[model samples]
Target chain A: MKTIKGIKISSGVVSGPIFNFERGKLTVPKHFIREADFDSELERFNTAIRKSKDELTQVRDLVHNHLDEDHAKIIEAQLLAVQDEEMITAVRELMVREKKNVTWAYFEVMDDYEKLLLKTFSQFFKERTADLKDIKKRVIYHLSHEKDIIQPEIIKPSIIVAEKMSPSDLMHIDHKLTLGIITRYGGVDSHAGILARAFRVPYISNINRIQEIVSYSEIILDADNETILLDITDDIKASYESRIQDFRRHRDNIISDKVANSTKDGVPYHIYLNAGFVDEVKAMDPALIQGIGLFRTEFLCIERNSIPDENVQFQAYKAVLEKMNDLPVVFRVYDFGRDKLLAMLDLEILQEDHVFDEWGGIGFLLDNPEILKAQLRAILRASAYGNTRIMLPLVMFVEEVVRTKEILETIKSELKREGLAFAENIELGAMIETSSVLEELDELAKYVDFFSIGTNDLALYLLGSGRMTDLTKNYYHPKMFRAIDKIIKAGNKAGIPVDVCGEMASDPYALIGLTAIGIRFISVSSSALAAISDEVSKIDVQQCGKLVNSILNADSAFTIYSHLKKFYHEQLE
Target chain B: MVRKEIKILNKYGLHTRPATALVTLVSKFKSDVFLEYNGVKVNAKSILGLLVLAVEPGANLIVEANGVDEQEAVDNLDRLAQQKFNLE
Candidate 1:
């Protein structure tokens, strides 16, 4: 019996069998040249290539129906791999000239093509087989048993430890019969990690060589602390009993409480959630949030090759609003720059393409003015049911706002002519993110109903920060506070309802200071709202106001942050 | 050659799904049907050509056909758009 230690991403425990699956890897083995079987070897190599292509098709068929668009791309990529010219050429050369066996030729070509994609690892299934017949038998078994066997009725569930799990693997695995996942291969931010988060399942990635540790039995997992308490001895069982009690206590507290955040002094404030995809929208329990803060309408408009029609948009918006019931839900109009938008629009490559242009662009919208109006018209039509506000992204000048408003008016009049009953006095807002918008805030806010300060864009734009890498570091930096101060002061003077929609709203300390800075409505992820609101209820906002006032007087952001941190520790108690 | 006019009726105008329906409809005809918007004529089968025209709702689009069954081609396309097929 052995125990393994790894990072715990999800919280749960179960004990089951060591069903050792073949891990994909790459290794070059020295084989003696046999002149007698040379003709047969070449034939075998050609047959293996044919077999590999067929297997790819089978896997694609199995997953195509069950997987989402993103997962389907992974299968498409694998199919592309099967037909790759370089791989095909290499296999042909080895078989026709080098006289290698079918399996050898396939492995050799995969090794050569390994470096092209980072995630597609090339690994030979090395087993201690005495003859070629044995290796072929194992290969057949692997292919035949690819259909995952799941028995949910089995009382004892097994923990699945793999190098990485594909989307199909996740779909097939019986969640009721499976305890958890421990991967030695994937990053915390990879697709698998995101899946685990979405499923609300406990998983840990980046655990090194987990297979060598536990013999698949007699090992216990503690997902809550990401620890594996091993050696199922008599004393360990006693300890497990005690830990179970503590686990139940923790679970009870989280499941029972559902509070939409209020100020420390019992003052009410709106805490809303931002949803991009339907899965995320469906996952949100509205009893936990005030309303949908910002439904990123761009996903529906920007994901596919062409924009979705008003009815498609209507179904998505109506479903979300219906789920929320009477709650006020806001939708941000499709924000597309030159790069993110599809130039050669097709259904397949639409989601695969990135928003990268020579002008440091992040979207595809410059040439597509009609697409923008199509989206705006859709949003206006959907606003007829429940309270819906239309917000624009990357509005830098007053002219853009005026033109957008004119477009809205045209759509509204068209709707009226059709005798469509729509939301009267629908509020229009702009995301204050661009430097140009900041400079023209006073004038721009006058035309819109409110302002949602997109600090993620604001910080990146001000510091000339990279959107992907510099987000976390720059967001927490003191310079970000100074920018917040400017935006808050502008919003306060303008009398427009302003809310922070960036990741910083999730921060416990930032939430406190934001309320202290005189900004009330804060939008964050639904998961963090209850926790942050609980923290807010414990702080003295008046004292935090004094601390903010002192911090604002400081010369630099560094001094201001340090002063606030120290004040939070000393005075909050 | 034959010409037929149809008003854009689907809430989604000549996009991918509707583009697909229109292509399938035109492919059945012996005559080649051409879609025209703002005086620019394009092959009804060309997805890229149709998208460039950017015909919204309530706009008048002209369909011209030239082939063995030109009249039949024009009649079929006109019926599809006017009836708002594949939309409901």
Candidate 2:
């Protein structure tokens, strides 16, 4: 028996046979074309291009129907690349000049372009090299008739092992026939990682030489423990089988537990789920969550070639509201920036020296008033179906709030002119993420109905560390809790309720601090609802307040974290 | 032939979408449009040629168009550059 340690991206345990899927690096076959066969080879190249384009068009339509238009845009870009006049002319010229095979000619042309792009553009544009390579792979596959690694059909339920998987590759994976994912490369913030988490699949990444070590072996993936047990003995296998049964039973018990939203001391706090996709909303248990705190609208824009029209946005928003049975849902405006760029909206990349200065949240919306108006109009229209609210992200300035409110009023008037029905009393809010907003909380609160403190960004901005990075995990900072405390106090002064919808809200240790700060509403991922609710049921609000007060008086974040850990073991555990 | 010097005003400079827009717009005219930046000249109607130039914000380029619609093409392209390729 052997055990390999890896970073656990998503938490779950499963044992199954390994389906080893390797994305073999394409080695272009270099050969001189025979003088007699030159014309036929050139014809073959043209046919291959035509076939690849047809396949891409089919893939684009399929993705559009299955996922959304945004995802379809990725393949659309590839189609355009295939039809790019300059790239095609360059390849043709290379083939004619060197008398080389089609594969080698195509590779050389793409490689030269890629190198040029990498040298000239910033990292943001340099990332497009992957897309270029993706297009290259499609054409090469057509030329060579090589089967794509991620074929739709899988014979059995097995753990998918790969050297690396791209976002597009992850989208095509058959999740039902897959037990878990073990990969040699990927960060927690990768698209594959995010999808795995959203799907509640057991995933582990950065497992060195995992493909070599566990080739088609019966593997036990304990994501909770971050261990991959390989070739286990019969005795161990029996023990794990029972353990799996126990774990499932325990999970079922948690799900079935009829727990109230209030703490043991009778302090009621609201718990909502953060959803970015329709599938997440459909999977949520209404009884477990009170409402949807954050519906990330950016997800709808990421993969599409064009900005989603009002009807498309309206349908998505309305579907979530209908599924949630009229529960209070907060729709955040399209927070496009460095990570989420809309292909249709050709907005400027606003990064100054690697720092995202003004591209996220309200800035992007304000810069493009038309896009913001479309979203506001859609959200306002959807609000007619259920209880709804609008939340703006990355609001660092009071002027931003005022500008957004003005835009909202303009959209409302336009809708009124059109004689459209919308909820009259839809509330508006802003995410308290930066210190600039925190300082002006009282003034900003006057313009909005409530505040949802985004702890992930708040913590990162406060500590000057990036999220999901080693620097963030290693550093202990209590500044975020202090920021939350200040925001809650400001909300109290303004007679508004403040909620938190960041990673901190889902964390057990952070929950203690949050409750202590008098935060009444907490929004976490749906998967974390049962566990967090279970923890909330055990917490005594008064005790949490006192403990947190002492911890706050402590020196640093490290001290507060250690104190909280000790308190958890002594009391909750 | 008509020639005019202009600077890229968009925050992200001439990236993919803007490059495509420029190429598509130039292709509409009967004129042959050529852009010269820092001694490297490329056909303005070719997306790959424009992208390879990798023009950033504040870079100065001379737009030259020659044909029956040379004046109109150069004037329209200069206007597009001034408006930051319509990507405000």
Residues B1-88, candidate 2, lDDT per residue (tens digit)? 8889989987877876667568768889998899998799988876656766888778899999999999999888988888887766
Off by over 4 Å in 1: A1-261, A277-288, A299-307, A335-367, A464-473, A553-573, B1-88
TM-scores for candidates 1 onward, in order: 0.55, 0.70
lDDT of 1 by residue, A1-573 (tens): 345566655455544354333333222232434667666655554454455455445434433532334434344444444444445566667755676644556556554333322222211111111111212222322222333222222245556777665433454345555556777755443334434543445566556767564453655666656666545776776667666565435433332455546666766777787665565676666676677777767555322323566677877887777677768888887764432232212122222345343221112232345556667666666676677888877776778778777877887898899987678688888887777677888888789888888876677677775432324445445566666778778777888888888767766656656766776787765445556666666666677777666545656646655665676677554
- Number of the top DockQ candidate: 2
Residue-level lDDT tens digits of model 2 in A199-235: 6678888889775656636878898898999878878
TM-score of chain B of each: 0.89, 0.96
Model 2 segments more than 4 A misplaced? A20-155, A163-169, A189-192, A246-254, A257-259, A303-306, A342-358, A470-476, B1-88
Question: Least lDDT summed over 10 consecutive residues: which range in candidate 1 chain A?
Answer: A122-131
